[model samples]
Target: MAEALLTLAGVHTHIGQYHILQGVDLEVREGELTALLGRNGAGKTTTLRTIMGLWKASQGRLRFEGRDIAALATPEIARAGVAYVPESMAVFSDLTVRENLVLGARQGRLDSARLEWILGFLPALGKFWNHQAGNLSGGQKQMLAIARAIVEPRRLLLVDEPTKGLAPAIVQSLLAAFRELKATGTTILLVEQNVSFVKRLGDRVAVMDDGRIVHAGPMPDFAADRALQMRLLGLAMEAHT
Candidate 1:
């Protein structure tokens, strides 16, 4: 079997003695879209933050690309080929779309082919190349955040809540962009609250609750088991149907 692209074993974290992540374990295989699903405050976002070094793990092992990176700083982690797009869609509000893309390509020059490919997936961004990032709609900002991550040479992309507050039409567009990214060999670990959306794009689903993963399996498995959906996701088929 191939090695995991990212791994967390027995991870524990706390915020001033309040445990946020307790014995969390996860493995993200290369070139796969793995969705981390949970209700609010289930530690889904915290898992991504811990993996990216935003919050230090009090106890655990984190390995990325065959190297132990538990002790590395956030910037060092990013330099090692892991890119993160936070829930807020952290774009430079004053910077033009082109400038934001340029900043994301840390090696100084944007890969023209890669840039074009990303833009093709998000044609709205192409139309607003010279516009300030702040002026774009919420969905557009999310697209810009994702585009920036892929413009560089990233081995893995960790995205938190990519469809948080967008309309259905825009959300569909973002999902299509994710598919395009996967087609180009990008590994994605997405933390999402949108169950149907994740089910459509994810190869596997990891259900998180109270800072730990409770269930994980192929997407089809969860799709067929309505009991698993209600128990893990608190959703009935009737709610979605």
Candidate 2:
């Protein structure tokens, strides 16, 4: 078994008088893709945000490489080799694709070889390298957003709903990108509603509900049990695909 790259024990998060995460516990294994699955309003996004320190955890421990990170600021977490790709596809609309990636490099310089590597799979970004990001289509914007996150090496990636609203082809492209990233040993905790996507790529699975992780185990077992899926996710795994 691989060591856990990140771990959250009894995590709790509050959002302006609303308690979103209540005693959440999860572990993302090193060099494996862990899927965060759930119905709407299950606090999956809150789990990712809290791990990134975008929202403070009211209580519990968040550990990265056995080091406490519950109190680290967002930038501090980024500097510690953690990156987040939000569900909103938060690309810099005003900037060119090249410029947006340039900003994602924390070292203040873009590495040409690295940029070429990212462009290899996400070739859509290569097409609009000089064009404004705002002019790109939804799928293209999503590619740019993920490309930015990997412009530099990151130890852990927290992604939320990455396949939302994308075409089947675009979703396959994302699956390919994530597979390649995993080949390079990038540990990822992905929150996704695309059941097919998760079944294809996830090594470990965790199901979230009402601000808590209700069920977690190997992806194959979770994917095989339709009864469990319907009970926890409120939809049959087959229906979701």
Candidate whose TM-score is highest: 2
Per-candidate clashes, comma-separated: 0, 0
Residue 42's C-alpha lDDT in candidate 2? 95
* Ten residues in sequence with the least summed lDDT for candidate 2: 232-241
Residue lDDT tens for model 2, 177-239: 999998999999999999889999999999999999999999999989999988998777777
Candidate models: Cα lDDT each: 0.90, 0.93
Give me the runs in candidate 1 sitting further than 4 Å from their true place. Answer: none
lDDT of 1: 0.90
Q: Candidate 1 residues 26-86, lDDT tens each?
A: 9998988899998899998889999899999999999999898889999999999999999
Question: Per-prediction RMSD in angstroms?
Answer: 1.3, 0.9
Assess the local accuracy of residue 30 in candidate 2 as a C-alpha lDDT between 0 and 100: 95
Instruction: After superposing candidate 2 on the true structure, give the runs of residues whose Cα lies further than 4 Å from its correct spot.
Output: none
